[model samples]
Target: MSTVIRKYEPYNRFKGYLVENNIKQREVAEVVGLSVSQLNQKLNGTRGDFSATEIRLICKAYNISPLDYFFYD
Candidate 1:
């Protein structure tokens, strides 16, 4: 049997979206129900990744599709 590994980097996509859309980190954190500090930690790779629920909230708040994070470059 063989195992395959993939690099999943949604954080970078999220950051790019923020920059492109001119959305502030604090605004995203508030919409996703996280403290700005916690959001920063996740964005900076110091804390755990965003949960499925959090991702959904972010997409909903920003009117974006979750697929944008997973499928696009």
Candidate 2:
């Protein structure tokens, strides 16, 4: 039996989206309906996971798709 290992791709678009939108972290928090500290935790990689509802809220707030955040080239 062979164990297949895949490289882990972190969810990194939260910051990118903020940058592209010219939004500050505080501003992103407001737009995404999250607390500043919570958003910071996510951006700083302290939070290990984002709920599906959180993902949807972010996508809806930013007018993007979940695929846009999670997919890689």
Candidate 3:
């Protein structure tokens, strides 16, 4: 079998959380006060890091710890 690789490994855990929770990408973008494309760019590592406030808002909206999504092994 061929191995498939993801473009955004750093956010893989977060992506899983979103999927498991049935959270939509547009909702996340709204919560973070960003456009969907902008959010995608950030998640894809094409853009730089998210601002502190953006992270806080996302965590608050989802009631998730940053470590669970941002900091990964």
The lDDT leader among the candidates is 3
Per-residue lDDT tens digits of candidate 1, residues 3-73? 53323343777788889989899998998899999997777666777788998888887788888763455
Using lDDT as the yardstick, the better of models 1 and 2 is: 1
Model 3, CA-based lDDT: 0.82
Error of 2 at 42 (Å): 1.1
> Any idea how many clashes model 2 has?
0
On a 0 to 1 TM-score scale, where does candidate 1 land against the true structure? 0.75
Which wins on TM-score, candidate 1 or candidate 3?
3
Question: Which 10-residue span in candidate 2 carries the lowest summed lDDT?
Answer: 3-12
In model 3, residue pairs whose N, Cα or C atoms come closer than 3 Å (at least 3 residues apart or on different chains), thus clashing, are none
Candidates 1 and 3, the one with greater lDDT: 3
Q: Name the lDDT of candidate 1.
A: 0.78
Pick the winner on TM-score between candidates 1 and 2: 1
Clashes of each: 0, 0, 0
TM-score of each: 0.75, 0.65, 0.80
Q: Tell me how candidate 2 scores on lDDT.
A: 0.69
